[model samples]
Target: MANGRAGELVLRERRSLGGADWLYARLRQLFKNSIVILALAAVWEVAPRTGLVNVTFFPPLSEVAAAWWQLLLSGDLGDHAAASLSRSLGGFLLAIAVSIPLGLAIGWWKPVSEYLNPFLELMRNTAALAILPIFILLLGLGETSKVAIVFYACSFPLLLNTISGVKNVDPLLIKSARSMGLSSVGLFRKVILPASIPTIFVGIRQAGASSILVLVAAEMVGATSGLGYLIQYSQFSFLITEMYAGILTISVIGLIVNYVLVTLEQRLTAWKPSARE
Candidate 1:
């Protein structure tokens, strides 16, 4: 009984030590990852104050943070962020809904792909921004146009990646599943879909980034409320600090969205071996 109790104590101690080690390692990794961002921030803060850069044009990071805080307090940031996020999410979701199934169909059906290849090639080669005027003319300078442009910008990446994922699935896996007497639908559900998920997520991340970038540009045109509009208005009014604040907000939002998607991807692909491992 005494030996068992001693063993239990030892195990508990080891577990505590393991937990501590893991926490320390995580903190160290975080610091290493953050070093470059910290260095850039330090430079931004010091350059203007030390006259390494013109203070008028490039205000210190501290000033920008202050402006950002003021905007937050005034509720302007919330309102603009809401508008931008809504537009981005609307377009992004629409693209996902349309692209994924279509890509799967195109990849699976040779005839369908052959029929659409010419048109797909032509449209994919055309830049989203290059056709912005057409969207504006057709949809008008309203939320519809902005959302349409973002949707257009985000669609190609998602569609192409989905097609690639489906086409590139391992033939051996499909053969093995079929040999096991799996039906076509079962084979797709069990093997193809799982195998294609990582690639689909890659497209999702790209489309997410494109959605933000394109929406910001679209908002700059005729938007009365959005981060892009805020930046533009601030710049025109010579509110440089506020402009920087808006830009900073957009950057933060991008980082957050990317981090969220990465986390989701990691969770979904937990069975896959990571390079870090």
Candidate 2:
């Protein structure tokens, strides 16, 4: 009887576990992994307070927070944040506009793909910063130039991802849809677009990141009113605390952008399963 009861309990537990969906599973997985970050923060806070490490380069958490508070109250932080966001989003939006239709055409049409893919591969491989001088010469050291640099940096990933996503769309699915009276337009709209979304999103996420990186570099090179500028200014003045605060701002913005993109991807691609889940 004891052995039979144990088997019954195991079966019940498996069934219960199987009932949870991907969201619940992922939350559980992350819960198990977050201990390390909490421990690191503990160390950061503890070491400076205890004088185990020099506080000059690594300002105490309290000092950093104080600097951040002062910046926030003065509205300077908000202004810098807005400037960076404008540059990144403006460029990112332009990339999406240019890359999506071009990607579709290149992916679906063999002649176009063969003719254009080689050049695209070269551009994608080239470093964005390497051509900064050319951009500055063509557009000057103005907002237009900064935005253009970001667009150049971000467009490659979006184009490549769009092409891959469209090409890898299942022919069998398209055939079945056609058999069921889906016209070329209908089939593409319903099946192709939905099917390619997961892969296409990967490119979009990368493009978003590239936008941030390129914008920071642009600001570092010339701009005087962004988070990157704040860091540079603080460094020149030897205001180490303010410099660290600017760095923390950059980190926070990157984290927020990544989280938003991840959330959007999850919401849009409900049919897929994540590895973590």
Candidate 3:
């Protein structure tokens, strides 16, 4: 009788756990993640209609939505968005390709670090936008100039973060590895590189934002076919709704890019304990 009762209790406990798991899965599947976004959209939709702001300058959300749909349907938005994406990605990738290796070398070698530090500080201090005329003069009012602007804007963040991350790797960890007779290459590969991954990702995120910002400004100056150009043209033509739609598209693109980078970071760092826990 005792054994039979024990078996019955175990079965009941298992059933309870299974039910809880099922309920959690259902909740996750049914979650409405856009509630807050929808609420903000509602406010935007209502504000101009209520005369809280001038609809001419600050068009209502409904008009913006209509414009967005129209642009999407007409396919003009896609072409401009694609052009902007190409420039942004081209410059950003070039920065990453150059910055990471250079950063690693600087962080690892005292001579390189000392040699580059002053020049880096000087370059980083200068405003990237301030160099627009120089770039246009050198590279012409072409894709090269715009892309170079993005590269200049994005490189500093990643390069600085990489140096910081590598240099900040715990000294004790290096000592430990040295005591174990690890080679210089082995120490860097096994210890310093792993420790710096998170910080490097942080730099990547910052660079992505910078790339978009600089690209937009560069487009505003000379481009005839990017989202920035679209926004500028719409504003000049007094098509406030289209301008707002372009602005909204930029915001969404930024959010999506950041979201992707964040997701990638989370996956790569899953072994680390999250603050939420």
Candidate 4:
């Protein structure tokens, strides 16, 4: 009985040590991955103080952190972030809803592709920012215009990628499914759609990035609320530190958005051999 208890204790100790070793390895990897960022931060904190850069325009990292904290305490950061997120997410969701279905149809149906290809080619070639004036004129310089511009910017990537995903599905997979006597709809649902998801998500990630970029530019052009507006207003008012703070906040938000999308992509594609590997 005593030997059984001793054996159990030994097993538990081994597990605890293994867990601790894993944690230490993870932390070490994190530090290694972050080394460049840490070095850059050190330079940013040092350069202005050492007069390598003008302190007036390029405040140290500490000053920016202080300004960011002040903005957070004053609730300005939250409000601006909320406005930006609402506009970007609204436009992103709208693009996803409209683009994916149309892309699938265009890719699957030769007639539909022929009918729309020319128009799509022309529109996609035109830059979204180049047509900002038209959107503002049609929708007015309100939330509608901002959302519309973001939608326009994000749509092409999603549309193009979805089309490519559908069209490029493996012929062998389709043949195999058909050999099993799968119907058109069943083949699409079981083989085509699943195969296409990774490609579709590539577009989704691109559009996600575009949504943020276009919205920031739009807000910088004209707006009363948003991180872009905050940065612009701070720059104009000569609140250099605050402007840097807003820029930093935007970077952080972009990183968070990208991380979330990547996690979602991993979850959805967990069955893929590459993902499992």
lDDT per model vs. reference = 0.90, 0.86, 0.90, 0.91
For residue 211, what is the lDDT in candidate 1? 95
Stretches off by above 4 angstroms in model 3 are 1-36
Give the residue spans of candidate 4 off by over 4 A.
1-17
Residues 60-100 of candidate 4: C-alpha lDDT, one tens digit per residue: 99999999999999999999999999999999999999999
lDDT (tens digit, per residue) of candidate 1 on 1-277: 4446446655775587797785786688899999999999999999999999999999999999999999999999999999999999999999999998888888877998999878989999999888898998999988999889889988999989989999999999989999999998898889888898899999999999999998888888778999999999999999999999999999999999999998788667766765744
**Better candidate number, 2 or 3, judged by lDDT:** 3
Each prediction's number of clashing residue pairs: 0, 0, 0, 0
Candidate 2 positional error at 33, Å? 5.2
Model 2 clash tally, residue pairs? 0
Winner of 2 and 3 under TM-score: 3
Candidate number that wins on TM-score, 2 or 4: 4
Residues 24-73, model 2: lDDT tens digits: 77678797888787687678778988899988878777788899999999
What's the lDDT for candidate 3? 0.90
Q: What is the TM-score of each candidate against the true structure?
A: 0.92, 0.85, 0.88, 0.92
How accurate locally is residue 98 in candidate 2, as Cα lDDT from 0 to 100?
Answer: 95
Error (Å) of candidate 4 at residue 271 is 0.6
